[model samples]
Target chain A: MSPSSPSFAVEFDEINQEIVLRGTMRVRSPEEMTDATDLIRRSFGHGGHLVYVNIKRLTHLNMTAFRCIADVLTEACLADPQRRIVIVASSVIAWSAPLFETLASAQPNLSVEIYDSAFYPGQTFVEDESFIPILRTQTKMTWRHEREILPRHGMKEGMAIADICCGIGDFATLIKRQFNPTRLIALDHSKKSLEYARRVAAEFGLNSIEYTYGDASQMLLADNQFDFVTCRHSLQIFDRPDILLRELYRICKPGGRVYITNEKNSHCLGEPHSESIRWTYDEVAKLFSHFDMDVEMGPKSRRLLTDAGFDTIKVESFMVTNLDGDPRDFADVIEAWENVYAGQMAVRRGDSPDFIRRFRQGFKDHVLAALHPKGYAGWPIWAASGRKPF
Target chain B: MIERQVSPEPGAFEQMASLTLDTALFRSEFHLCDRVSEYLADIVAQSHEDPARYANFSSQLINEMIEFSFRSAVPTGQIDFRLLKNEERVRVSIEFAPVSDHQPDWLANDTSAIANGHPAVGDLWGLADAIRVNLHTEEHKENHVTLMADFALLEAVR
Candidate 1:
């Protein structure tokens, strides 16, 4: 089909070993375009190859459209065990970039190449050779962290685990691969994220897992369903942290373990920067303490466990060094901190651009200097676990 | 709080309409139609001194009352109202029909139950009282009046 065609067109490029899709895949109301794409993809039987979806002529799209594309790509990748799928798009100019990135991260074999006119004028395709290095770097970093932490917590094979707030199944996938868990139920709120996770699981041939979408606070799983519950950087966002803890307690089997990790003085861990942040932290802290759990502050982790409730509570501290020792890592940390500071300042000033830019730049400089080798700044993360009494 | 002279040549319709408007504007809590009836009765009782003038005033008042009520009840929406006379009384009825694509799920089931209860009954009685008060009032003493009102939900058949 031509680019102007209203319907979708699929063709295989033998030279590039890529499957090229053109034209608007959006069909009329109620009819899913992904279903049509799937039919075409299956007919071609091109397994483990790069898939380039050219949306240059596409004017409109929604979550459903992205989901459909993800489904087709996932199925094709799964069918071919040896090959991987690489996605090439024009740029992150489209709202669908986040959705695409989310899917790529979830699907182990799927890599996305976003083409920018300024970055690469004519090259709009993602090559397999180009993606391998980037993929290897990310995988090694993630795997190293998981391996370091898993053994410390005594995570063993055949353990039934619940991964709370499993965003796109990044940590969940890592945990499953390293620990070789018998069953891994990855839970997240975003349906699109879960769809991506499903794709990843399919691509990796990891079938011993289930994906669920809902609020973790109201997880519908049966009580005592999991031998272990792991939450990574998710506890502080809860309206009632104690309620979540109690829910975790109820769901975990007797003698089961619960692990939670968050960076200290980090936005993700509910640290306060201003009055508003303090107020939010106070409310969250109140919820965390309400469940009658004993609290112990460690060098890395502020551990909370109850002898009356759980048999044991242990808190461990660990440092993650950037093996590359790149200054960009420290810059990224400062940038994240600056973003939080600027956001808070903006709220106070009613979103004035002058105040936001000034505060952000100042905060970034201050944080960057602090994170330098001799600056006495180190990223502090806390990991704690408790065992429910049998 | 303000007083005005009643018009002469008031008729039964005029007395009823004036009573309806007066009751709606004054009473804080009363059945809707009963309030109208009461106002009419009050005007009729007081208009003995200048019957013709009060009669005329009452007719104009009732016309204004009907116009105002019709506008408010329908409110530029698809709500339809009809004034019907049966035997000896004038009955003003209002019907609200669901028109939008997103209709409230419980509207059909609850409207019937709501219409059957004392709340709707009280509103109808208040309207009647207003008519009665106006007919007996000094502004409409020469006119005789009867008033009633009912509410119902109408579903369109496919």
Candidate 2:
């Protein structure tokens, strides 16, 4: 194995409990594939305890190599039904965990978990006036859309609505257009974003949507005034989400719904190994636990509303995909992301510029050349909504 | 300011692929051309391995079209612009309906027919792989025109 070839490098742990596979591995022929299988079997080493195959150190992960590794582990599990295989992959990789999970779904002893090496989600330069539209386009959203997260939450024709931390007011305007809320107040603390939102709304000749500037944790709006309260993709920015949630609950009228959607893949996908903003469902549950909320949910929907003391909670997921192409449209989106990523990294104080530049280029190449043709290029948008007690 | 009623909703022109310049003759001036040209150059620079040649023509094409719109007989409501990717080249297409019945003579004939007399018009042939223009007098008030200029994308630009 060439030390710096970036194709395949294997390092076995002295304890023999774990094996770290690094770099992009491709099997050119069946012989090479068989060799990779033998190496993985060697790593298992007649083990009775759970064996870990760590792909977290891989610079550019190749799924083919991992599939081979998974096959070896499956045969091992057949030999010893109690032997467990833990595949530790970086949180940034889109397909690694899912692909492994699918492979392991059949076998009882195999599992995949995201290593907590994600970048810290921060108030990126996305707050800048110019960036809001490009970011929204990445998610295939407009100022207002007939198709939305609103009607699904039971928004009516003329009820009052408030969008907290509503950067650029895209979702708020969308709700107003789709549902015709009697009073649509779009609120955000950032002057730049609020101004942009106001200008956009004005451009649309929309006078009904009101723009207010205020922090989510300390909104000046009255309680029980809004029919619906929503905050999307901004929950991670608050120093304390618990305070914001309590405020969301306070302002929400009895039986009114509160919806919280986390942009999971956006925050975690392409996250670096050094930092983590990959808030797991458990982390989200723990974060809200301080406020005595319990939304231990499913893959797409978690019952955060139930934890927030709301009855009749429903969790829904929205995903935008089949965009551009594998390398073509995907490359463009990644480049658009690169436009904001450096500034976001700077905001988080995460990695050095050198490291970020390298990762950005490497990820583009990996996605373009090695990733599956119909791979995961989208973030899982999970929304949890529940009503206040009537 | 032009009465451009565009919401944050995705416009026909979105992202780096295209940008719409829907301003009145009084607003755009020479500054619009320079600013948009610079933006196009930046896009080409970022997208191409070697941007020097493609960037040059993109600026020239943008300037001439803005000149074409500015010199139109009447004020036009909107002139749409897009940079599209063809199989082998990038096509910069500009669509607008000028409020004039008299077709612009510059576009009436092949650019080379008057190349010597109008060097700026002559430069079009050198800068583009193909120049396709569609002009039809709309019965309402304006003459619809679509100018599509294809530039060399090479292996680098894609």
Candidate 3:
């Protein structure tokens, strides 16, 4: 929730085209971006552009809150390429500041410099900013036609289904509403996320969809109990994707269908990837095929499923497009690709500081080019399904 | 620089502790102590030159404390670690106040130096520069043990 009163102060230098933010900024607080947007509107006057943003005294900044701030700053700075942001952080924040430099570099327009202590004219300093507004827009994405994916699985009126590692149970809730499943189990490792899923399920007045805390490596549930099982956009990130696939097979009844879907490799705009994202699907298929369940990576990965011994298998790809130029829809697509995908990859990869600077610059240019006048953007989901032999 | 108090009153059981980390709420019975020790090692080493080499000593002290407490089945143990900046030293004290009719048998006869008693006998003796134990047997049957270790700045440790 927002503070009863602002914990921040903004001083705009209209003559010099500068905005100096003073005081504490609780980054993830409910009204963080709202306050920033107000400040930006008031300061930038026309295009949210500033010659400088002096965040030298904004104490109590953290990585979690930094993410919330960075998203906002990236978009705002995109307004003018020549703008600059300078952050003067205390020694306490030195360890995390250089990485913050990496994030600020994500903005193609803005030039950034950071200093562990306040910079004198001859010395140097860096930039940071905004994510809450983006979070609000992303959650309200355009709905998908589940029939484009579900009926192919023979989902009938009373069949059982499971979504493992179901983050917040978005897909599970959608399937429950569309397919009228008699029983559904939503499992994830995070108890906090599961609690949110339960609350969402209750809000929709959904019963019979049980929420359980479980690990992907070992689901502490009965084997061969589910008629259909699914895990989406999760395998590649697992420490052991192979073990997780086998676990999926262990819980599927004979003749029941199970599918795993992961994104195409080189996710940043170089398409025409192979069936295997990190490893050959044939190898994955061959290794786990012994478990008595047929496996496939995605719809495009037919050869691997056939090689794995599934005589009959189905494959399909669905393109998700924006809805009617809604700013929120465009923002949602931008959020997924920019913040969720590219941003995380940058942090995790641990690239050299200069390399990060160049990479973030290039990434921003690439994404801004892809985004449309109306925020029009689209991506495809490749899904392949195979039934365990009867 | 933080002075954290975990639970109960300060004078409740006579605690001269500076920072108290409360693991009472979380169940790290399987690995909590290990994680705390690991984290402490990182913080304790920040000012030292051979931080990595001199690391894990704090972990050793905490591990023994956890072992002794869990063995005695003491409920809700508290960890208080203090920084003696003037002396360039750190002290970690683990206490389980009013541990019922008796304390852990190994601890009752244990030395303030704490050597050759429990299975993890070598940890404290090998790591700590000094060790001491204080048992509050008057009102609360409390067992508080403290370990003081000298860590060098880049010059001193080297």
Query: Which candidate tops DockQ?
Result: 3
Each prediction's DockQ? 0.00, 0.01, 0.02
Question: Model 3, range A284-312, lDDT digits (tens) per residue?
Answer: 23322332223333344455445444435
Task: Show model 1 residue runs off by greater than 4 Å.
Answer: A1-143, A266-303, A322-330, A333-337, A340-359, A366-377, B1-158
Candidate 2: regions farther than 4 A off:
A1-121, A142-149, A266-304, A324-333, A342-354, A362-376, B1-158
Q: What does candidate 2's lDDT look like per residue over A1-390, in tens digits?
A: 111122456766747577777544533223566766787787777444788877664533233344466567788878777788888865333234545675577788888877642211234344556567565554343122225556777777888788887877777766777778887777765657767777788898886676754446534344576778887766654445565777688778888988777644423232232122232222334433333333332233353455567778777665443333333444455455555543453224455767556545634532343234544444345677778887
TM-score of chain A of 2: 0.54
User: Model 1, range A1-390, lDDT digits (tens) per residue?
Assistant: 011123445666655565655433433222557455765476437433444544332322322344466667777667764556666654212333433565666678777675432211111111112322333333344345556776667577889999876766767777787788887877765545666677877899876676765345544344676888887655644434565676577678788888776544322221113333333333323323333221222232333456326556777665443333554554455454444334542443365676455555544444444455544233445677788888
Please identify which of the two predictions, 1 or 2, would achieve the higher TM-score against the true structure: 2
Clashes of each: 71, 9, 16
DockQ of 1: 0.00
Q: Compute the DockQ of candidate 3.
A: 0.02
Model number with the top TM-score = 2
What is chain B's TM-score across the candidates, in the order shown?
0.23, 0.60, 0.50
- Top-down lDDT ranking: 2, 3, 1
